[model samples]
Target: KEPKEQGDAKEQGNDDNSTEEPVTAISEDNVKDQSIPSPTPPTPPPQ
Candidate 1:
């Protein structure tokens, strides 16, 4: 159940990144903090 939940959350984050830049930033930080291993689409370097 935990793994399934995490997988769904990760996919949700990936999808959210498209419609919400703020959410994408937060999601990226969460991903790093959680040490999520899923491959995410390349995010351009922050300026």
Candidate 2:
């Protein structure tokens, strides 16, 4: 049997939230873009 090391109990902080913020920001931008109305129409006729 092998003996374990004494200083092997280190804290493992594995928080993977790097991509979440950017994705949420992009989603909010898209929703805001759709929420706002466009002043120009598809086709305009000359008077």
Candidate 3:
């Protein structure tokens, strides 16, 4: 499988989350996928 830089890893991460119960990691990845540097907080995990 491709190394899925970060964005893709996030998708899989979210999917894996529901199965693994790591919502925090999913939220963190969502933030990282947005604006790269603007991965602040309170604005991610809307998907």
Root-mean-square deviation of each candidate, in angstroms?
16.4, 7.4, 16.0
How many collisions per candidate? Answer: 0, 0, 0
Ranked by TM-score, the better of candidates 2 and 3 is 2
Poorest 10 consecutive residues by lDDT, candidate 3: 38-47
Error of 2 at 34 (Å): 0.4
Model 1 per-residue lDDT tens digits across residues 1-47: 89999999999988787769877789889979666444333333332
Candidate 2 per-residue C-alpha lDDT over 1-47 given as tens digits, one digit per residue, 9 for 90 to 100: 12333233221211235466778999999887876644334234332
User: For candidate 1, which ten residues in a row score worst on lDDT?
Assistant: 38-47
- Cα-based lDDT at residue 41, candidate 1: 32
Please, what are the lDDT tens digits per residue for candidate 3 over residues 1-47? 56657778798878876876667778888877876756545457664
- Candidate with more favorable, higher lDDT: 2 or 3: 3
Tell me the TM-score of each prediction against the true structure. 0.36, 0.42, 0.30
lDDT of model 2, residue 15: 26
Q: Model 1 Cα displacement at 46 (Å)?
A: 48
lDDT ranking of the models: 1, 3, 2
